[model samples]
Target: MIGSPITPQGVIERKRGIGKVEVEVKNMQSDKDREEDMDRLSDLPDFVLLHIMKFMSMKHAVQTCVLSKRWKELWKRLTNLALHSSDFADLAHFSKFLSWVLSNRDSSISLHSLDLRRKGCIDHELLDMIMGYAVSHDVQQLAIEVNLNVKFGFKLHPSIFSCKSLTFLKLSIWAVPWMTELPSSLPLPALKSLHLEHVTLTAGEGDCAEPFSTCHVLNTLVLDRCNLHHGAKFLCICNSNLSSLTIGSTTQETPYKFVLSTPNLRSLSVMRDPIHQLSACDLSFLEQVNIDVEAYFNAHFQRTHLALISLLQVLADYVKTMILSSSTLKILNGLSTSGSMITQIPCFVQLKSLKLKMKSSSSISDEGVSRIVEYLLKKCPLAKVDVINCRE
Candidate 1:
């Protein structure tokens, strides 16, 4: 056995044995090195990891459970949860997944934000349970966009209105031909931002209470195509702390009146619609005004023209920047010919920037627009004017 006239076959067998041993040793070393290496992701603190996972969808966050033992339980501590019903195969699967997540998630950590978007069939019970969970967990921001099923009479969990820690709440309900009734009282004292889309707000009449009056500290309010259901006759938005307000409704005319009492409003943007009888208290603090009211110019020109005048009168003195729709030029051209009211137009004392937004459908000629610009320039000679043309 000790090299007694070794043949080529014997030498080859010995070399194979040496190679096998070397491979085994290398495998052992590699395994040891892998075991010694620490997972960089697992090294992150729970809050940091959770924050990073916020950018990922809930499904991907849950999929991280397969990565390692540490990640198995890490997803349960996610503070920002975004759950979409469409992510699952069916409503039942979505419900089961949601239930499992809610039951297993660390309830001690206060939820930072919960965004739930559902496009398909309505699940009122699931929605209520989710709201209840969010409310109980001190959710700071809650955004819910669901397709409304009017037959079921959809209602938000009562605890949402009473959440002490809630700061931002956005509820956008679509697919409902009729406006959804609002809860009589929304006493969310801590709420700062409220965005409502396609929902009905009933003014305080009889048992119903004014929805926005209690939002004392609300700073940003966006009302997109919302209706002021007239159980009371007037819809008053009287939040003194409101700084940014956007009212986007396409309805040409409505029976109810809108009253705004925001003394500290700094930014105002109204697009598409003009409230029939909107009366605003002193807006002396308004810094920027964006008025894009060209939708109903031809049909209801007179009323819309008056509303524009009123709005400009209220905002002219303090507005540093003004964005006017092309229809405004047409209105001004018409007003100049009609009477001396054009000269009575309020001067823009604080105006620094003036933007004329022209749309493709604008009927006003370039000469007319120039004339209107001349009139406005007389009012705010120091303000720089910029013309922007938009296609639809």
Candidate 2:
């Protein structure tokens, strides 16, 4: 063909053949590319593979040993280890497994987090050892959930409160959940987040703020279903760095007085069964609040319907941007069954926006809302009020 004389027909046939070959070559290349894409996960770098393994439980990670030698020891260097009781056959087996796994893990690697949840007979001593080990290993975040069946609660090891490396901690000690031996002075120097559930909290003779005295970097604190020890029914937090506070009580007659001394608090959320009263909120720096009193209207507590009138008064004192549910408006009505003194409804000086979550059964008409808006306008002339349907 290269030596042949030039002709239109020859040239045309030669060009068509070349085009057909080129299309076939492209088809073959695409097919090969698809196969390469299918094998993508295997070709990923080791660090990416290790990152993916962190999401799986330690048990699952161990099972990956069957896949290849590269994965057999990858879990030993995992930054997070979560060991649950259900994963093992029995408590004894679980204990043995924990010992083996921890011992076999690379001691040179520092742990970022440790989660332990086991419900069984009281084994505070064993737990103390395990938790102590975690602290010594430079664990930054620790979560412990257990059941202490004894009449009295177990006091945690002092190492936990004094741990300078911890940034987050969650303790859910159930049954006998009182922490009797918290240090007179808690010193979580680096703690940024804390959550306590099902724990009985007692105040100490030392400064009421001692328990949180040294948490200079704390940003969030959650107290859920916490029982207060008699004579110590006050939660006094004085952290300057605290920005978010959430308190939830599932029972009536909550004895605790939430004394918020956090001048930098950005948001506050209260979900109460029937919080009789709250200390005057100092909201010079507050920005948002969500108060859910729907639980207070339960029929079991309805008969005693204190109407949460006092609570409403306390909320109006410092609430900033507020979300008002229909039930809240009902309680704020002057003609409510309890005859709340709506005349005492002070203007929200800090509140810039008021959101009305209205229900179809709401007793307040648009006219009533306008009147309330007018009253608030006296204080916040530029206040923004939005009446939104409950469906929204």
lDDT scores of the candidates, listed in order: 0.79, 0.71
Q: What local lDDT score does residue 137 receive in model 2, on the 0 to 100 scale? A: 88
Clashing residue pairs in candidate 2 are none
lDDT of 2 at 6: 79
Candidate 2: Cα lDDT at 345: 61
Q: lDDT score, residue 306, model 2?
A: 43
Q: How would you encode candidate 2's per-residue C-alpha lDDT over 62-132 as one tens digit per residue? A: 77777767677777888889888878778888788778888898888888999888877446776777778
| Tens digit per residue, CA lDDT, model 1, 1-392 | 56588889999999999999999999999987776665555677878877889998787899989987878899988989999887888878888988899998989988999999888856667778999999999999999998756653455677888899999999987645555667756788999999988777765556233678788789999988776655556667788899999988633245456678889999998876575456786888888889877535467777667776777776766788888888767777777767787875677877889899998888888888877777766767878999998878
Pairs in clash, predicted candidate 1: none
Which regions in candidate 2 have their CA more than 4 angstroms from the true location? 1-43, 85-96, 118-122, 177-181, 206-210, 250-254, 274-276, 295-318, 326-330, 333-337, 356-382, 387-392
Lowest lDDT block of 10, candidate 2:
300-309
Clashes of 2: 0
Top candidate (TM-score): 1
Model 2 lDDT vs. the true structure? Answer: 0.71
